[model samples]
Target: MDGTVVTDRTAETVGADGTAGRDALNAAAAASAAEGSRSEALRTLSRVFGYDTFRGEQQAVIDHVVDGGDAVVLMPTGGGKSLCYQIPALVRPGTGVVVSPLIALMQDQVDALRALGVRAGFINSTQDFEERRLVEAEFVAGELDILYLAPERLRMQGTLDLLSRGTVSVFAIDEAHCVAQWGHDFRPDYLALAVLGERWPDVPRIALTATATPATHREITERLGLPEARHFEASFDRPNIQYRIVGKDDPKKQLLRFLREEHEGDAGIVYCLSRNSVEKTAEFLERNGVPAVPYHAGLDGGTRARHQSRFLREEGLVVVATIAFGMGIDKPDVRFVAHLDLPKSVEGYYQETGRAGRDGLPSTAWMAYGLQDVVQQRKLIQSGEGDEAFRRRAASHLDAMLALCETVQCRRAQLLAYFGQEASGQKCGNCDTCLTAPETWDGTVAAQKVLSTVVRLQRERGQKFGTGQIVDILLGRKTAKVIQFDHDQLSVFGIGDDLSEAEWRGVVRQLLAQGLASVEGEYGTLVLTDASATVLGREREVLMRKEPKRPAGRPKSERTAKGERKQAVDLPEEALPVFEALRAWRADQSREQGVPAYVIFHDATLREIALSLPADLTQLAQLPGLGEKKLANYGEAVLKVLADHGRLEAGTALEDDSSSSGAESPSGD
Candidate 1:
């Protein structure tokens, strides 16, 4: 096999400005392989794999494997990961045995290779005895290029014996992060993969997964017994998706509004926390005239498969499900991913939202976040039979997410910081906070009052308390809980009367976000940490941001358009007509294509086309959201509209400056 070999690099290596590095990697591979007297294999690799050259660090990873070094790859999804191991498999020896976790994915991979005219087969429980025997015979005859295996098969009596009989080209573990208990989806069978080295020491191994924090990374290496494996991680950020967290009083109503106005007729996933919630939410959407189906482990396998197929084949079908629906389901054009409930961790959030906008199209990641969701998720994590340390870490991550929800600052900034990366600007100008522009106040006094109350109560009752009781006592409300505990006698009891119950709740939430407050599991009570001491003593100042209550039955149009809510919309009469026409066109395209209307053309894109009226493909492609693919797909139709209106002639370049820096639409696969 001839091809350029590339190594996987850390995310930092493939920065947002990585085109130059990718080209260099491709060029270097072309040069090195030819000089090694395998110039033919290099060219063959490119031609067969449908790549002109190698991508970032792919060559290095391929070389390590071909040279017989065990490796761990942490490439992001859709980062050309398969080629790294696949190229070496073809060149190394008789048969490359790949251990994969998903049976559905195995079938898809084999089908894809067969489409490319490669001989690939999988031996698993799904195949009958005769079928397995045929595949085994083919493997013994040294005829198969790639053989995919489930880890469960490795334990069979004849499995290791047959493996020892043949030349094992390479042992590749796909979704290798499953080896770690820290991972969202852990599989015990993955632990069996480590035995491959003992069973066949000479065979090189490659383990790969899309999402893994540093902890998962370490676990993958150790559990797989590849202590010295080289590591490669791509950047975790998905810039194409505009992340938004909406504070909702009625999440179902908000979801319906999004579906009608923005995500109508789009294939999307809505994640819920329970099987019952999944069914209820799906039914709610369906009753509202949306095409949605429920998916959970409770549903029969056939129903789940039918719903999944409909979602992939047809546009605009919503699959309301638990997080279980997303693993290995690789539908790339999902327009939106809405969470009816909060995910447990940032890692889970990133992976779940990553399902949308895989086609490099602008996509909406809309989520409704609230306090109860956080509390519920934390309770679930603690309820599990885990060690105290694990529970503490899980609680910490939950607090981080809750803080993200409570922050009136840039959502992108908070999320990026969680991953240890700082965003370029204070405002992403795309999230609900940047859009709504919530109110901010110097909350130092309020924080002090809340902290003091927690401390005073601790001294009085010798117990932890919940938020309701604390807030009631702070606001000087004579609630039964407060009266029963005689919290009224505390020095801080009547001091917080200046703030309303709602206002004090905000203060308490912010305190939690700041890590000054924590929930004690043993007592189901709020406890002040040592960090709260300074604040309570007036040594530190605290500030708070809160959202103004949304007006009842307020129309969305009256709602501000985020960044330019106050900016004047000045338009010429000619431009107004054209803008309406553009909207009409988008609506029609969305209906015909069965994708979200934004998928055809986001509002920003429509504004650009209305102002510029680009006459040809070359100019349209330059506009934001109108990539080469989109231009090729809809170029003629768009230009024809402009031509009919006599706006295509003398195309003038209007100011490209729009309220949004990037076009917001659904793209990615």
Candidate 2:
């Protein structure tokens, strides 16, 4: 903001002798200023954003981007991806241009930055012409620190010309996975973003995403023309979210039980498969005394915005939504994300469930999946109006999702392996499969019988049968179709008579997952693949675990999420009310200030304040989130809240105060 360092394009030229003398002095001053600004990035991180240090992969990302090098960042949903670009945007000179995908997210990002006293603005269709001109004037005058724009606006010539006139510092492309054709969140506008490399060849460009596979990663770099950019990949694993999949039987009742018993009065998201389901589920929850709202493409924009606003500001608001929501939600305390229907792919499931437990607390990724999901997904993948390659890819992704759902090994390990990271031996004790440790049975004989039946049926009838008919024949059930086909006389028909329907289903699902068998055609006809030969010939053995069944309307007895929980802030029982009061204060302030509550202070910080009960503004400022400006602004109120709570706990045990211990909470495993 100093005027001496400001560059002028039309200034008059000076004499060589005078210029030489001035240039030396200017170079010295610039060197000193650069060093100061480099350090200022760290200072501002604490003073403005209220963080004492950079998180994992954040400081390195900031250093790389601040040094004017391009970077490709792949971090988890709550992994502090914003700070990687934000810190550098502040440390580097000129206004930071961000290409955001959604208008709703643009508003939240601007509000959050403004809350931290950063001069941030956004340009999008939501703004009128006059508003756009005002932001443009401020941007051209270099009064803005960060200006977010929709991808379409960024590709416009007028916007491009405007950027050419100013010292544009950095270009940050959020949700860079949108450029990949095979990704679920693909957007055509992102394809135009490759021009950023050509237009501003010297400006450092950073592409960031919370969801990406190895294939998607390659596509993003190629599309964005960032093949040579520095790369920083934080672990894609969200360990705070405990993965649990239950068989769907009376889903509405099961969902109610989960809410009433485990997560009563906690905020969460219920993802449904259709708009009707979203609306119906919202109504169902409301009828059962749980406050709920619906969100989808069918709802009016005004209604959607209101619902989102309430979900962000209010506590215990359940949003039953289709896949239309939760892409860029900034709410940090979502305790759970429940899937009423199976997601289309593993990437979508991972990204959606990750919206929960962003604060490094124990959260849940629960799903009620069943055979119907597999049928519907298979139909969609097989009969969709796409090319052969696209359909095959869809089938592949669906198969992978099914594998994760039915995997007997660690769910986290299976998921990480899909993204090319191996973790076979590193067990995550949080997931349901890992927690229960189900018993396995030698399924090699069952696999051989099933494969032989498929081969016999194909050889005799010149076609295979669906899973239902195949199961009927295997169980020796003399159904009408079985008798008509004379399948009862086959050698392998009665060989599987000992297994139950559920057990046979498990074996079949495992066969499909392990690539020993495949399903073909619209009827889901069972067909044998190459791997079936090894199993049929006794060269490779097969083992499978029976999938556990869930009670229709009862909650699990484990009290791990909220009760018997392990969170970053461990306050004593006496300090619980004070923590709640601090949260109430934060919510009220967030409403009045029109920003997300975490923008003021995270729940972890409030918990610390309640436990330690800081006596004055000075003690409060010593906390990680209470920086200089915030100390001057809300420090007194925080102190009052803490002082009142301190008196309430004055007779409590004389525990050591640790709200300002200056040690960071360790990240999840």
Candidate 3:
């Protein structure tokens, strides 16, 4: 929001220069509400909700559905895809039936909508008979604008019968990619959604998903029977979320440092590869003065529920979890999403990292990627219970993900290209690649040394060893295993003594990524691939990114100094107090209403209100996010806050109030 000037050059794409290319979200949302000559939609967005403009293709998609046409929306996670269908549902004739995948997601959306004074409700397994019956009665009575149903419930004949009895305006299928078997978050129940095209031939259908490759995209269209729906695929770029992939050194300490240096007293999610890692990371964080809770399928149902509730309802509490957590997480204020291990695929990485900065604020997606991740992922692909085709597909996905980690080009461009979208420009000032350009060295000699050693060990000695063993032999480490194999007698032994162990590791990892070598058999032995010949013969120059030095096993020196870190919010000092006061009020209101804090207001909205420093309802109502319901509901209280803070200025910048309790160490709820 505070970036330099960038005028709108393309309407469908969100440019890398931040919000400059787009109108204010609320303003766009409000203007979008005026779809028809006399748009109730525009009023709903500004008054009931708030906002004045639409983002990317949101207005087009909304208008398509409102005009009684099917649609497919492929926008990024934080790109406001929900508004595409939500606005249309309000403006169109009857209630919209939304088939959602998860109960948590459904509830979160329902709560946020109700907070806006929109007649939204959901019926899921989480609700009892009475709760479901009340929502059903509302639908039958035409008292609801949107009804969210789990895909499983929507698949049932009883639910279909109920829908048939009511006046349904549109059928909205969310998380549409889940229909594809190749998708990482596949849901079998989603396949039944295809019947919607047959059963509700006249009802306009809108299918939406945040993550989908060309392959996954086709599967979704074919499986959902929406091949003819007007497609609105917005650029899948989150420039506000900075991407950084660091080599694994001490993961816990590295994660701790990230928290202290860049994300102090902010909400975030930490992902680990295993249940054990989740538990250990949570415990480690708590012990080291960062509040955290563990969430995994292995945890008891009640415990998991409580932890998730705490993570959502409480501010600045980190949730350390395995892949078992975080899909369709509606938390909008997460400042960072850290990965202690490499995700299995690029789709998974994109979806997980997209979870941060959903509120359109600056956030970080930090990962400690390394060689162990590569080995484990390969083992997973090879050991799958499915047939060879499935294994091959899984391996292909893993290779694509690895290439992304190893790419020398702009990370955002490569990532966008992976999704069949061309980035407007290169060098997005966000990712580690663009921010701190890593110097590349000609790795021809290093590649030759590793490839020759592997060949000699296999052809001359009839031995195939893992990467570590090969490195040990080359570094002249005559350990018991090396002595047993008599690998020390080889000509290539000690040839790689010129590079540090970490540097050699870089060469080895890059070789595996580039397909110059491959892991073979159950022993995980490394062998040269056909591609190795070019690098070994000097026909092609191997290039590698210089891996940064890993700090020695000491925590203190590893912590980046406080002054070097960037401040997340850039606002005037005068607005700082008002921002904290608003946050305090929001917390109180959320607790009173028994809803998540974000449901009442997003941090970005609060930041805007704080910086504007509007002294009364008229001025406050004009603020970007103060929708009709929000203004009528909280305008007086907000005015009281500004009045209490003395005379307000119009152009005050936003500053963080460091004195707030948010900066304190955790005393768990």
Give the TM-scores of the predictions, in the order they appear.
0.71, 0.85, 0.88
Query: On a 0 to 100 scale, what is the lDDT of residue 471 in model 2?
Result: 88
lDDT for each residue of candidate 3 in 1-669, tens digit (9 for 90 to 100): 111221232244455774733555444444445434126566666776568777788778877888788998899998878888888788888899888887866777888888788899999998899999999999999999999999998668999999988999889998898898988888999988888889989999999999999888888888999878888888999988888788888889988888887787888999998999999999999999999999999989889988988888999899999877888888898989999988988999999999999987788888988877787777777776899989888888888888989987788888999999898888887777776677799998998998898899889988888888988988999999999988989998898899988888888888888878788677778888888888877898888988776542113433335653323555566667778888898999989988899888888888888888776788888877778788888889888877765544332322233334445735522
TM-score of 2: 0.85
lDDT of 1 by residue, 331-417 (tens): 556778999898877778877888886655556788876555655665577677789988877877777777777777887777767
The model with the greater lDDT, 1 or 3, is 3
Number of backbone collisions per candidate, in order? 31, 0, 20
Per-residue lDDT, model 3, residue 432, is: 76
- Cα error, residue 266 of model 2, in Å, equals 1.6
Candidate with maximal TM-score: 3
For model 2, the run of ten residues with the poorest summed lDDT: 5-14
Residue pairs in collision within model 2: none
lDDT of 2 at 238: 85
In angstroms, how far off is 387's CA in candidate 3?
2.1
lDDT of 3 at 633: 82
